[model samples]
Target chain A: MNLLEIDTKKYIPKILEAVIETWGEEYRYILVEKANKIKNINYIDERGILHYHRFLENCIQKYLSLKFLEEIGVDTSQDDKNLGLPLDSNTKEQMNQYFGNRCIFSPDFWKDAKGIFAFDKEVIEDFRKTSVEEGQIEFLNPLRGNSEITISNYEQFKQTKEYSKLLKQIHHYLDIYKKLDHEMKKYNKKIQKYSDYVDSEDKRKERILDLKRCELYQEIESELPESLRKYLDLKYQTLEQKLRFLFPELDEKSYIEFFSKKDEDNLETETCNVYALRLCYLRRVGIHNNLNIYDNSKEKYEECLKQPGTQEFIPSFELVDKITRTREKKYEEGIKEFIFTSQTFLENFGQMDNLEETKEYVYNLILNRTKVANIPLADEKNNYPAIFFPIRPSYNGILDLAYIHEFIHALLYFSLYDNRWGSGFDICDDDPALLNPYRLNKRKYERLNETITDIYAVKVKNILHKKGIYLFEPKELVNEDNSAWNNTSLIVRKMLNPFLEKFHHEVILSLVTANYSILLDKVGSENFEELNDCINKVDYLIDCGLNLENPEHKPELIIEYKKEMSRLEKIYHNMDNRIQVVTEAHK
Target chain B: MDIRRIIFIKKSPFRMEYLFLLQLNGNENMIRFTGLESRTDKESINSKVVNDTIVTNFLEHFFRIVSNWNDTYINKNTLDATTWNIVIEYKNGKQKEYQGVDSYPINFDSLERLIDKTIKEIGGD
Candidate 1:
């Protein structure tokens, strides 16, 4: 017969005594959680420190000790009776293996915390003292006689009945309930009183405030023209959230008014690209759908060409918008001069080709030999690579260049320790928020991607110019050259203002308190500054916009940025791939 | 990318809607909102068959911002270079490069302020 099958009629007294002694003082709190039978307050905060409740810990310890002592099964203990504990094979094995018939468990122990000891001092000391040569110390523990007590006998023995008084005493706590109903009735009377005063002098002031709130909501609900208001409000709340990012201090009422009014005012000029590339990418990756995305995007694409210098390039946007801007000439003239100059410069440098396809790709995204704007770049979760031009015209040049850069980004992404989602090609889904460009992750990734792109754009522009492409002219791609890229680090640092407002108070604190690592991924040593700037300032972030756009000091973005930056920094340092090598090299 | 050039300019309860933003690579890296002026109504909203230079010019203006980074030679050594301009070409054959006279070289910190100004002016008084 199993040990649990033993007749509890004999040894229960000893078992009960062991429980009482072992429990010491902590019987109330643990049982409180199991109070379905008792029905106490569920109103107490679920978030209070659980382990600190000594009463609860004691109850659990009592339960565990009773079971542990019963399993050890001492001398007929009091009347040929044997206390039995239902120890499954595994628990029995654990008991027999290291415990050697003597084990004292505190019930407060947690496991598997590494070289980092997370267990209490008693548990640690027990583990240390019980090992090998010191195993005899386990027998010397104060609990050595724990199994000798009999719980059943204690319950029946008149001499030990005094010990059960506390159990009865606990029931008296129910006395409070006698008046609880009366108190609740009193509460109802007060509520009635409050109702009676609803129209009184002081109540009128309160009613006025409530009326104001209602008026505000009604105004928000019915403020603008129907169709236009609906469209604008929906966009403001759902798609466009710039107002929220810009004015985090604005109250809910102010926000509705600000955005609704801004919408009313700008709805006349409102031109959101209903067709987003992110939606397109998500669909292609099989994570989402955009039904008529191609049709929609194609329209926007055509509209783009009607602007200028986009020429016939239709695949890449960055090449047209960003890459070619570093040159000296207007786009048309610049491309021509670049082809002519690089043809000579590369020849002079002993290379054998002209930058023809490169020029075509450059002319594809942007049209000028000047500065760029609103360039589109993409980063993904899984390796589900998107065909991003980053700007316009998606030429072989940009297709090639951004491809390598994106590939590097993809590699760094994989090295991430805290991936909130999946790992391969389709790591990212179409972000509903990407279209707004203010999402935390989206903004960070875009800035990181673009700053790196700027590096190449400046590099490519310089090499082309060094080859005598200046036959057209030279544009400053560097800040020293009087360029925005020249001082962007400082601007991105300033953009970090809003991060400060949200740190200790909300978002980050919630994550940290829950022990979820949101930004603890492996970032480069160089990027530590960007990380600190971004994080330390989270408390004040609402006061500022989401981006680090304050305090004109240039921050080392590579340092403060969080990610698998070490690997990326290595790639950034060792990379020698050009647009051609990158695009063509990747199958 | 892979854009189509057909657009519908505002006419009779309908106007060409262009998405605009301030680009960082412009001469002052000014935040400017320029979009494709509607050309023709060829499935205007969602077609990618942009086969014209006029629409292409609008996009090129964006690149022009990039090109102007070092090409600050416009009207150099003269009073003309002192002012800035915005070039606008209508599919109707009306070409105008308005002297931005009142607004130009907006400080980097205040670019959004400029956009607010432009968006405000464009919206109305």
Candidate 2:
């Protein structure tokens, strides 16, 4: 009986029909249709016979495997094993390996294999209960498709849609796990590389210090919450302390000296005098809110006095005559215009009782006519002599006083306009040293000049009042603290009272013309020098008193200032007494 | 080349002298020294740790104005004024020197004020 010549197609149908009776109609298609296709024997050759034999053998093996799995209560239609199988351990192990190696049915047939195999219902229920207790069977699974599955109900759980969906989910999770593992491996490799690079203790310490110095770490720390950031800060500070202990040369205090020594080595050729010039420039131009101008003024005076040829006196008579003539012309024109064009003056032309009505008119005329010019000195072209009116013209009285005071300054500069003698020094606009007592040269006289200006201003006011042009009241310029005129008025009046009373115009002329030699000749050189020294001492006393009044000074400094002030006051008192005696002798 | 230190000196004919020194320690800190140019007497010299940013700003401005200045400046008009000198030392052991008397650059006042502001920040008068 040759198997190939046995008419396999006719016998295969019979075998498939018998198999369907045993394993239900679900296996009908695989056994009948698939077996018929495999038995397509063209000629009865050796190769054809071999092929037919192999096909029959494979069909027999699949049938036996499925029948054995069903008898043992294993899921033949799905990949899952039926734990309800009442079999020995050796047989279970053999069946597990057999099922794992091959599928008994095609994948399309396996989809409908559930409920086709027959099993003991009670054993399946028992297995289902055990699976539930062991958390193996999912009764209310949240996955898609079948919400619940039990061993007693289905013979193949894996052939269900829910199992396929679960398989896909597992694959998705595994892919994600693989990606995470790869990233972890990469990070570990980077860490190892860095560790290998900074292997030595010294190199590690240097790397740590460099990271601490970097701004990137600070930026990252700033983003963290306050508590965590503070904790990290403490940790870093402790680490830095340890690092500093390891490196003794990085001590903060000694670092300054080290750096300074290095700088000194680099600057060995530099001298101190060059730095002094730079310092002087910085002092001159720097905007210091708390500048001690008194100390600076004293320094400037000392510097000026030390220079041999700083105090040369040379007066130009021609320049003086030119200034006087111009002043006379402007004064005449201003007075004429005031009398002729002023409405107040027109209404009360010569009425002495109505002088108050013409005060504003006279003030306007003086303010309008006062020519404030920037006259450059002969030598220093960049230096311009500017007369500053430090007072506000809020009232007619103040306006008149400021006008006359500035007029006197203008007259002084007018003489300097064409004179070569007034060329050495710069007439700085806001110079505190230009205030009083210190006379650097003929062009810079603060004490005598201010005294003369104040006296002349008052005299002009009185003269204008007598002439029925009341520009300001007599007592308007009498401020005890602020008025430079009032401060110097007493000493100047006492010292020059006799001479002023005798030759008031000549004294005024000589002072304004920068002709101090004329006054020296008149007063005698020794007495002139003494008087000048006395004036300087009075200014020194005033300045010392001002310094003593300042509350910002330290108590010890205040004590010293008081002592100096008292000494100056005594000296000034003696000088005043001597000057009075000299005036009396002159009188 | 990286600048390591800068020293500015000024001497007046009236016997007054001053020194302004700025030094960089590594890359983090700057040391400033200002006083009467008495290197031996440390008490006369005021030394303080200043911010590196301040020194950097000063150096930036210094370089800008440095181009306008010559290696030597002499004022023929006045012989009694102050004399100024500056030395810029680099990390490569090279240096640049400049000196002036009375005469100065066009924006020298700006440089003076910048140095004054920088030193003042570190408590220099």
Candidate 3:
């Protein structure tokens, strides 16, 4: 039966029942909610129909495919039936032959990563110990034990669940090893190619140097004796080796100028262009290796952590308004400058033939930029391939941080690592209490990029201050009317200010190459817990201070901040823990 | 008593379009608000019965925050910006409407809550 043609109203119930049986109530709830949402939409509309079709096509199909592929060891790519295409008799026979008498192993254990060992040390050791010549070693399942101790036999092994689980691990490990090997080979080839290019470049430079030397000799030929000039030509093959061939009567300034001109010619702006071209190649191929590693890490996180959600969050009105205004002001003042800067940036960095086309492309960006909450944005729709910011945030006192912060985001995107500083898991998904004491839904860890950018901005601000350009003064207390909650904002800002003031330069310097995920992971999970604890504790202190009846209590809290250095010490120590360490223990 | 005055501005970086739907009880006049300074009489596009429960819930939510609404919330640098300013007149001649971003009073979280509830009760567009 055609999957799309199946009446969803009739089949959804059956699918929900199966999902509930296998994955439990949570999965069923999610599935039902999704299904009902789609069913309500008028599918007569083309877009509506497409959405409905996609929902049915992708929903539960991945799991079902994995099950089928595992049961029949036959390659699905070779069979039309497996691909949901019209069946052929020869392929059908091949499929039957493949399935017949063969063990239909439980693929879910491997595919879903439900198996006990995820690259377990003991399992790996056992596998390594056994050879094809020595025969297979007896392996025990971590979840289950052998009631009757059994040795390895291909047919007999299929009867035990452990065998299939082991096979799954083997398959996974083999795939990873293969991928790693392929990458290593590719890197070797790149290194070799680079070396060859460098060698040819050096040879070319030698030829150029010889030609320049001959030209220089001719320029000063009249100043030299005929015998001396002939002897000078025979003395040197390369210009750089010696300078004794120069005429004593020739002006030293002229000789120096000539050599400097040659250097200037060699180090043209085109040198940067050559490097940029190399960077483009490295970004496509070499950077892809890093991306794979990043993907693997992300997959591991997905397996371990809950899928982040923002359903519980209602965005803060005050914060949203401020952010909106910040962006709006940026667009108002920065649009013209942004265009000029973008044109210059593209001409310098981007390889292009037509200047007019580049301007037109940029002009379209200005015209087509998306607006959200009165803030001009270049989000999903009308998104340019390159980092094209038509509007930049205007620099206010601390708002300059937004300018530098956004610029960094653009820089990171084009960067080889594609260091996504602005992109992260929805902070609203996390518990409100885990972040800043003032704002309930502030995302500190997930918004690591913003923090880093803020740190960088502070560093830049300090340098500018030293040069007599005072951007803005750091306030000890928050402006009551400006914030949603006055006291909370004041306390939190004061608490964070010291760290930003003291460690700004050092922290920014350290994080030049590190991406958002790397920075967070390296910072250690303990620091995050400590941060959460500190925020909670500070909140407690602030609440105590805010008691209207107890006038002395507020004074006491301020005194405590000055006197009680213990909390600050712990927090500072926590902040110091950005270095990565090997510590997690395996069971 | 019907929708007395309806003004909405859909502004993006690319384009800005304004729509106003106004109705009078006896005269039976309809006008489409084009710009801040311009209006066109779109006589064919007259008011319909917007007495549905979902619409009522939206109106109620808007009225709750009417007092807090800012008179002039102008922003020139926003992209994909949407604002709706709706005014409804009752039989007693009392009028209430919301004025906020994205065609709803987003400043008041209650509007979103109400909308979500409405969607759950009766499926949304």
| Candidate 3 lDDT tens digits, A1-587 | 22112222343344334334432354455445433422110011112122222222222232233334444454555433222112244544432332222111211122111222323444445454333212222223322354333344545755678767766755664454334335444534433433344345335434443444444544444544344334445665654433333411111111212112222353232122122222222222222223321121223323322423211111233432432333233333333333344323344223322355444444443333311111112231222213222221111122223223333333222112221122221121234443445433234432233333333434443444344442222221111121221112345445556655554433332333333344345455566456544555555565455432355667777565544347767766665644312333321
The models' CA-based lDDT, in order, is 0.28, 0.40, 0.34
- Candidate 2 local Cα displacement, residue A95, angstroms: 92
Query: How would you order the candidates by TM-score, starting with the best?
Result: 2, 3, 1
Model 2 misplaced regions, further than 4 Å: A1-268, A271-410, A414-419, A423-507, A517-527, A534-546, A550-587, B1-50, B63-105, B112-125
Docking class of 2: incorrect
- Could you say which candidate leads in lDDT? 2
Q: What RMSD, rounded to one decimal, does every model reach?
A: 33.9, 47.1, 34.0
TM-score, structure 1 vs. true: 0.18
DockQ of prediction 1:
0.02
Prediction-by-prediction clash tally: 128, 11, 9
Sorted by DockQ (best first), the order is: 3, 2, 1
Provide the TM-score, chain A, model 3: 0.24
Cα deviation in Å at residue A571, candidate 2? Answer: 7.5
Per-residue C-alpha lDDT of model 1 across residues A1-587, encoded as one tens digit per residue = 11111121232233223322322224333222212111010111101111112222222333343343344442223221111112334544444432344322332233321111212233355565324213322322223334333433432432455434532432232233223324444434433332233224224333343333333333333433344344446546632242222112111112112122322343224222223332232233222333334333445534543644333212233322222221111223423333333322233222212245433433332222111111111221221211111221111112222222332222222222232321111122234543213333222233333333334334444443454432111122111221322212334333343332323233222221232233222223233334433333331232132234443433444233323234334433332233235457675
TM-score of each candidate structure, all chains considered together: 0.18, 0.25, 0.24
Give native contacts recovered, as a fraction, per prediction.
Answer: 0.00, 0.00, 0.11
- Highest DockQ: which candidate? 3
